[model samples]
Target: MIPDHNNRDAAATPPDALRVVPVEPSLHRALLRLRVRPAQRDRVGSMADLLADVTQCPGSEPMAIMRGDAPIGYYRIDASARSVAGRDFAQPARGLRSLFVDADWQGRGLGARAVALLLEDLAVRHPATRLLVLTVDCDNRAATRIYQRAGFVDGGARYHGGRCGPQQLLLRALP
Candidate 1:
């Protein structure tokens, strides 16, 4: 269990054995091969695209979701939601962007597990964060369902800027 950043008395549930690691030179080739399903290629951008954005986008941190020795998933956390989105986006919120599980790892429930672990770690790392946010293309029912089951609430905001157009914004409170 990881200790909460604000309250050391509390601990967030740790991933069974998965760890989210920072990007490293040695992992570049492996990380580059991680991809979502073919149909999802349009809805969800590639890891390469995320890497490009990470370079120009300040306050965005790219991370690799590692299980034992291999990277099973990839995601980014935006610390400056105010600057990326707007002030009304659940204040002091961290935006979860570009979350993707490898095509081979799908249907194993790893995505939700990864999200749970990531949120717990974020709570410890960002004590001031009151909420976590993410945007999903409305048609991506699978992704939406997993997030909702994980406690993300639909914020009723649609974004026209998504790759597939019209994205739904979801928000979750952090302890």
Candidate 2:
């Protein structure tokens, strides 16, 4: 079982036992091809579109989680000068876009770790930013839980016409 860091003492043990590294482009594409549940097949296309857009955008940044030199997962952060979903999104507060790990790498807390890393990198790059926002499927309990663990709170907004049901807005403040 994964140790609960919140309840454990500082010297008790190291919180994360696994290593997560940034994703390389080739490995990122390869890892993305790994199948999730049959119902999630549509995620592949959506993720692909986001990746392409981020790649083409002049200011977007993408990060990957790796076990050593091999990529296991990746996520993207997109900055918009204007509001994205009716919220006043200005400089620094990047939108958390595509985030996915290889099917074989799920359930290892890599998702949370990957997000933590992404937030850390963003904080370093954009010191003035105070918020991170993302949209997940309302029905994706697993993804919601991961985001919550990473300090994201429900923003009470939704986007329609996504494959994974209505998108639920979530946001968190950076340290």
The candidate scoring highest on lDDT is 1
Best by TM-score: 1
Tens-digit lDDT string for candidate 2 (37-60): 556556544556656776687666
TM-score of each: 0.85, 0.75
Worst 10 residues of 2 by lDDT: 1-10
- RMSD values for the candidates in order, in angstroms, are 4.6, 6.6
| Per-prediction backbone clash count | 0, 2
> Candidate 1, residues 1-175: lDDT per residue as tens digits?
3222333443232434566766666777888889889898887678888788888888887788886557888988987665334555535788888888899989999999888878877877887998888888888899999999999998877788877878888889888
Distance (Å) between predicted and true CA of 161, model 1?
2.8
lDDT score of residue 145 within candidate 1:
93
